[model samples]
Target: MNNRRLPSLTPEQCGSRILDAKCIVAFTGAGISTAAGIPDFRGPNGLYTTGKYNADKVFEIDYFHKHPEMFYEFSRDFIQILKKIQPTITHRFLARLESEDLLTGVITQNIDTLHHRAGSINIAEVHGSYWSASCLSCNQFIKNGATLDWWEEQMTQSPRSPVVLCPHCGGIIKPDVVFFGEPVRDLDKAETMIKSCDLLLVLGSSLTVYPAALLPQLTSASTIVVNQGDVMISFRQDMYFILSDLDAFFKKVIDFIDS
Candidate 1:
């Protein structure tokens, strides 16, 4: 982790950063929600790095069919986190931006629905979320609470539990999340938001993951990056770069906006 601090830009400076842009887009990741106590998927204490569960095997579509328990274990914790966590200042700031007509939409890699919770209506969850589940066999959608109840029942019944069956047709049930091998749910909408934006603000991502990572580059707008550490993107000198805690930085920006 790089500890070197980049000079802080004032709220006026940050506000001016996007003043000329008509359409502003925000790209977010796990880091954006970390302030709300959600662990990032690939961060130091993340599922992959901590090795509590194999991210690749658990998230793989085929592998999930063979061993659904692993995914359930992961989902159990994630669901609990979702239940307890609140959206941070950054999330609220973005929502406020939309209200002010300064932001067009949000494109997030996070599966957590903090952006929505924070009151952002124009959001695209590129990686999907735990809010909804789907039946693989029947194509029926189930609410998250219903799926959790069914999963709990399975755990108590038998060691070799039956596959999650759709209530409608008795077919396989899966979360709406985009698994390792699965294609993203709404690529066209995501691309449309990115391409149409005049300013792109990327937050809390290392910019390593593809498809979602490629979005910032697709924007012809001026791109601003705010993260705790170094980013992988090739940002121009004119583009704003704020290397600091996301919540603190955004709080400052919000306060500046209020003033």
Candidate 2:
């Protein structure tokens, strides 16, 4: 998109655009949840690169099938982090927009369920999430998906469950998260939402991962990126870039909109 790009946008200006938009959709990444203590999988000090979690073992589908324990171990800690943290300002702002019928939906690459916790109902978790899990054997989802208490029960067992398994089939249970070889969960739905929107807000993502990263280009809508670091796409003339803190930028936008 080489139309006309603005290098920077004031919070008030962004707020004005949002208020004037009839349908706004947000595309978010792990950066949006980092402020809430959920670590990004690809950030500078993220799980993969930081050596805290092995991406090969955790995200590779074949590896997961072979050594489910490694992924389960990561899951144990991830659930704890999710339990202790709340959604960030940006998350709540989008939820508020959804409630007011201003935002159409959110297309998120994050596995963290903060968007749901923040009360955004029309969300497409393209990366999948821990909200649900299915058995390796029967391919049946945990009765009602999973709850914090369910995870707590599994993780905190006296001897600790070596692997989370399906209660019904006694098969290994895996979170619905998209593994390396797995296709993302909701691309078509998310694409339709993005294409139908008048405005697109990209929050906290570096835009490195694809094909999720390519969704922004699928829409001709005005695209605004709010990220702290480098994004994969070129600074196109048609898009807008705001290199700033996610929550900090949205705090100002929220203040303006709520005013």
Candidate 3:
């Protein structure tokens, strides 16, 4: 529980603070990508909630090793969707902030690589991304984003047991997405930024997951959260919560900033 108690601010006050603040650090999650046609993990129509796919098995390293096809099947669809989706207005706004040097960087729990696609250069992908993959046996690496297409092609040719093999040594190639048991990437650097920034903008996260979820507590910076649903953090003096559509909220904020 937080000891500090701060009353909620009006939208205008929130907008004003955002505009005045320098070194704003954006913390993001799957919810930020939901408007871009990506399903959030715990939402009503989410991949896990719908039971359309077994998320535990799909993201567990042991399960991945045993039934690689299951994970690959999920990845194939995810990658295809990535190719079609564009960055949302919220994403674009954040990128604009970065370009104008108003934002420090983005710390994201997303694996979609949308922040990079949105032109946010300073990003710490806490959960890693599909930007790269590596082979387990020989450590052969695939750096570019071309593996998704190759994986889809393999799945098309062999619907039953499609395997993305390492061309170097016939080893299984796995995307760098952090599994349940895997350690998150760049967390130390992210925490350093979170603790030091003048403003910490949390976007579309429930703040339920461990380690990453603990980041807000580590920051003394003024905090503002914009999300469509309930966020997990308790009210504090330096905190503000906006339960609204992220795109609409950010669009209004951008207008306020420009004004």
- Which is the leading candidate under TM-score? 2
Residue by residue across 1-259, what tens digits does model 2's lDDT show?
3212447798999999999999999999878988998765676876677686777678889998888888887787778878999999889999999999999999999888888889998888898987777888999877344666677786566245578766787888888889989888988899899889999998888777888998887777777888888777655444788888999999999889879
For candidate 2, which ten residues in a row score worst on lDDT?
A: 1-10
lDDT of 3 by residue, 1-259 (tens): 3212334555678778877888899999887898998866667866667676787798898888888877887777677878888889888888998898889899999988888788888888788887678888898776555444655665576555566777788788888889988899889889888987899888988888878888887877899887767777866667877777788787777777778
**TM-score, per-candidate, Cα-based:** 0.83, 0.89, 0.86
TM-score of 2: 0.89
Candidate 2 residue pairs that clash = none
lDDT of 1 by residue, 14-123 (tens): 87766666888999987898899987678787777778888778789899878876887776666665777799989998898899898999999987778877888887
lDDT of 2: 0.83
- Ranking of predictions according to lDDT: 2, 3, 1
Off by over 4 Å in 1: 1-8, 18-20, 40-55, 143-164
User: Considering TM-score, where higher is better, how would the candidates rank from best to worst?
Assistant: 2, 3, 1
Question: Which candidate do you rate higher for lDDT, 2 or 3?
Answer: 2
lDDT of 3: 0.80
Worst 10 residues of 3 by lDDT: 1-10
Highest-scoring model, lDDT = 2
